[model samples]
Target: MSQCLNPDCLHSNPKGCQFCQKCGSKLRLVERYYAKSILGQGGFGRTFLAVDDFKPSKPPCVIKQFLPQAQGTATLEKAAQLFDQEAQRLELLGKHSQIPELLAYFTADNRQYLIQEFIEGDTLQ
Candidate 1:
């Protein structure tokens, strides 16, 4: 299942598609994970339920796209700092059983993304 990253897309494209069916957004990320669906959105970014294409079973993972609501030079710097801080926190907390494990964190195509082990359950609403 290829997920369209375009914020306006309403549907995901067919599996293995290079482009999205609805908005024509790229379907692959970092040439490994395949965005399957929108998991949720927050003030900082949107999370996607993705699959690790590099894995044989295509294990599910959470992909966090950094799309901060604030847009200024200083704000962007702070966002990046916070993002890195969170990544470090996750890396430390990953040793525990409660929090999800951080899988990868890097920038691609000028966009920042953080990948982690997906935890399956209802959100704590």
Candidate 2:
């Protein structure tokens, strides 16, 4: 069962909740473990290299947070929608050698987060 990550949430069970029973915030997909180390930060947002809590022996992951400034008013709503839509698209593109797998996507504290399988020993500068 998934537990609500929102601290203010009263409902913790994963059974019948669409949103937190107490605060109406969306529940977070719990990872068994993750250690985030900042990879880089830019006007767009920050990138982190996170060790998978679910499988520590396995490689880490890359998580990117989109910056509000990068998402301007002209495209805020549309960008947010597309950001989520692209994550879904990546999920469908799973395990392809040319495509990095999409691990998870959720919004917390009004910011969207995307977690993707990390390509170890890779550096983008």
Candidate 3:
């Protein structure tokens, strides 16, 4: 039985609630599925490289959780909405080889997180 991570969830059925009863967010998985390693940190948020447990043979993925500082309540709310929207957009772009696929989006403990496919390659620095 997996509990819905969305705070706004109305249904209490942890085992069968896929979408939040109030917001309708798909809520079957959470961060524990990934093996996280801190990759970097910046103004917007921190980046972590995590193993994609959902795919047994697949490579690791990246999860970015945005920082909530330096913004007013309205700005934060807008950013949250935009973040979710971008996740949806990225999910649609997942088919392309150049685009990283969006895996999940959820807010827990007052922070918003976005999980995406980690593209493995060299970095110029």
Candidate 4:
């Protein structure tokens, strides 16, 4: 199954589908990463459990969608800046064994996404 990346839709689609059945939005990001389900959501955006389909193994990964929910323009800009900062920090820190490695970061459909290594097991939160 494929999970739609559209925030408003997020409709589940059958395997081999290229677009969402309900919303018609493209299921694949960059024609590679496919989100399976939402992992968590916060003030800035949502983290999704995704897979890198470009790899032969189709390894699991995390996709961070920058969807700030701030009210004012200034607040939203700050939130976006913070999101980019986080991605930059992750790229630098990922070299450490404990930090999840940053895999890809780019903008798609006007939305910014940060794809990173998926860490299994329980979360500290």
Candidate 5:
């Protein structure tokens, strides 16, 4: 299955679809990551289950798309800045076994994304 990365659609698409049926958005991201399903979402961001093409096993990953709830240019800029900082922090914290390793952080299609190793387990929530 192919997952629509568009925040508006955020649904699974047919395997061969080049574009999203719901929103007509592209079905891939960063040329390497192919999202398969949305894991979850909040007011601040959304997370996706994706596969890395570079890996021989096509390892699953978590693609965290930054979507700030606040409106306005200044707010968006601040959100981007904070997201960068968080990426840096994750890089450091990833050394510990408990934290997921940060794989990549980049911007495309006027949006920000943080790709990390998908840790399969339960959460307190």
Candidate 6:
């Protein structure tokens, strides 16, 4: 199944679907990652379990969408700044074997996304 990233219509669609059945949102992000399920969500944004179709192995990855829950322009701007900082930090920290490697980060459909290597097992959360 492919999961829709739209916050208003996060519907699940069958595999191979190019777009969400419910909301018509594209199933793929950056023309590669297909979000299968949500891993977690918080005030900052949401994390999704995804697969990178661009890779030969179609390896699993984590996709972080910057969807701040805070209100007001200042709060939203601050949240966006923090999100960018988090991505920058991940890019640097990923050099270590202990930290999950950053795969890709970009903005699409007006939403910012950060893709990273997936680590199996329970999350620290």
Off by over 4 Å in 2: 1-35, 56-58, 70-74, 121-125
Off by over 4 Å in 6: 122-125
Task: Supply the global lDDT for candidate 2.
Answer: 0.61
Q: List TM-score per model, in order.
A: 0.88, 0.58, 0.62, 0.93, 0.89, 0.94
In the range 34-93, model 2's lDDT, one tens digit per residue, is 323567766556666655556648567777666545445767877777777878898988
For candidate 5, write residues 1-125 as lDDT tens digits.
89998877777888877788888887778778889988998876999999897889999999999999989999988888999999999999989888999999999898999999998888312
lDDT of 6 by residue, 1-125 (tens): 99999999989899899999999988989789999999999887899999999989999999999998889999988888988999899999999877899999899999999999998877634
Superposition TM-score, candidate 6 onto the true structure: 0.94
Model 6, total clashes = 0
Clashes in predicted model 3: 0
Off by over 4 Å in 1: 8-11, 122-125
Give the per-residue Cα lDDT of candidate 4 at 77: 80
Better of 1 and 6 by TM-score: 6
Query: What would the C-alpha RMSD of candidate 6 be, to one decimal place?
Result: 2.2
TM-score preference between candidates 3 and 4, better one? 4
lDDT of 3 at 86: 76
| Per-residue lDDT of model 4, residues 9-111, tens digit only | 8788888889899988989999999998899988778889999999999999999999988799899888878888999999999998788999999989988
Q: After superposition, how far is residue 10 of candidate 5 from its true place, in Å?
A: 2.1
lDDT of 3 by residue, 1-125 (tens): 33333434423434444555556655433634342346776766766766555676846777677674567989888877777787788888988778877877777656778888787665312
C-alpha lDDT (0 to 100) for residue 5 of candidate 1: 73
Give the lowest summed-lDDT range of ten residues in model 5.
116-125
